[model samples]
Target: MAHTTKLNTDLTGKTALVTGGTKGIGKAIADELAAAGARVIISARNAPSAESTHHFIAADLTNAQQASSLARQINDEFGGIDMLINNVGGLTTPGGGYSALTDKHWEDELQLNLIAAIRLDREFIPVMTARRNAVIIHISSIAARQALWNLNLAYAVSKSALNSYSKALATELASKGVRVLTVSPGATKTPPMEKFIADYAAAQNIPEESALAQLLQQTGGIPMGRMAEPEEVASLVHYLVSPAASYLTGSIYAIDGGALPVVS
Candidate 1:
């Protein structure tokens, strides 16, 4: 008889920095990494409304000066981290397609969803290159592939750019003992998503449940029949960043519950 046991995902000596880690998928990822034994640090423009175990730093990543200051502060205080989760993106622009979107709207969307991560990576990758087995995870979205132009034109385009950037960065760093990967989650039940649904329902004068159904249908209907829990996405991220997934890199891992119709 052979004995079998669970693989250890312990990150006892590793340090992790999760951007926008105060809430939603970022919060879930931060919590999961901490549980896996990593010393976690979270950053956002504002402090969390609720108390948390992780150290919180205030920095608006959209600003280059603030981002540089944030990196310097972290390197000074914590000696730099082994893991970087670029999870500080959102749909901050309005809907109504390209006609309604201005140059500023597109620029703001890119700043939040794409450029912030790029700046942070530039600041951290030098230190990370000197370390052994460092990881960078970009929290992307399914909209990168199946974009809904009417509702998320600018945001989706930004994520598409992010996905491309992640792949390129991963390739460049593959020989440097650093891993870079992207996690694309669809229809996650986060606070912003819930609010989007609520607002949509009000706009259409329909019940919340009906609005949800319609929205899902527009996205080709999830085979799982519901939005993914934030922790579910976190679990996948935990695996990818763990030592158990040492060989994985330069890939976009989708956690979309079969919502994407095409096989890529």
Candidate 2:
């Protein structure tokens, strides 16, 4: 007989902000948090579906002005947030060796993956610290450690910086009653990943399955034989931000399927 276990990851009165929460893993996380009874606020460059129940805000986080406006709107509308999820990042640069990346490429990657989170965190840290039990989660990638330079050189470097920043911030805030953590996911089954696989297949003139296999092999392959679902990642984020994880802070919670070859 199989037994089921229930998790205690409730966030009834929590107000949370999820940047890049319009779709993909971000949407999954926003939905999961709302289901746990939190008042979820989602922000992205585009609008969410009309059927979306969570409050939506449109802002390009890369722009300082837009980011500031976002913070103002959230503060005015909801006072402040109890949790922050910095998920607004991607591999937007062309993939090649060091020579392929220019100064702009490196700057863009850092702004999106590292500096964006740092700025947003700075804006809300005051209120979060006052709450004394707030949580800040930086959604990084496994590429931070296991970088495939040919595919995502700048992206990987940015995420590695993100991990380092998150650790230092966690240490600084530990005595101030706030928690900072990093969630590093391996290849997840999101719309972006699907598109990437499709593109690779087209570029290589191979079947999509073959393209996926090759891509997986490049990352040392996920031992679970599959990529993680967006919802699976969302579940981990929900747990980390919930009261049940009160003592958990300053750690990188990896949701990869044992893809990282060595212990971190």
Report clashes for each candidate as comma-separated counts.
0, 0
Superpose all Cα atoms of candidate 2 onto the true structure and report the RMSD in Å to 1 decimal: 3.9
Clashes of 2: 0
TM-score, every prediction: 0.96, 0.95
Per-residue lDDT of model 2, residues 67-112, tens digit only: 9899989988898999999999998887668999999999999999
- Give the candidate number with the greatest TM-score: 1
Q: What are the per-model C-alpha RMSD values against the true structure?
A: 2.8, 3.9
lDDT of 2: 0.92
In model 2, the Cα lDDT at residue 123 comes to 90
CA lDDT of each prediction against the hidden true structure = 0.94, 0.92
Q: Compared with the true structure, what per-residue lDDT tens digits does model 1 show for residues 126-145?
A: 99998869999999999999
Residue 93 local lDDT, model 2: 84
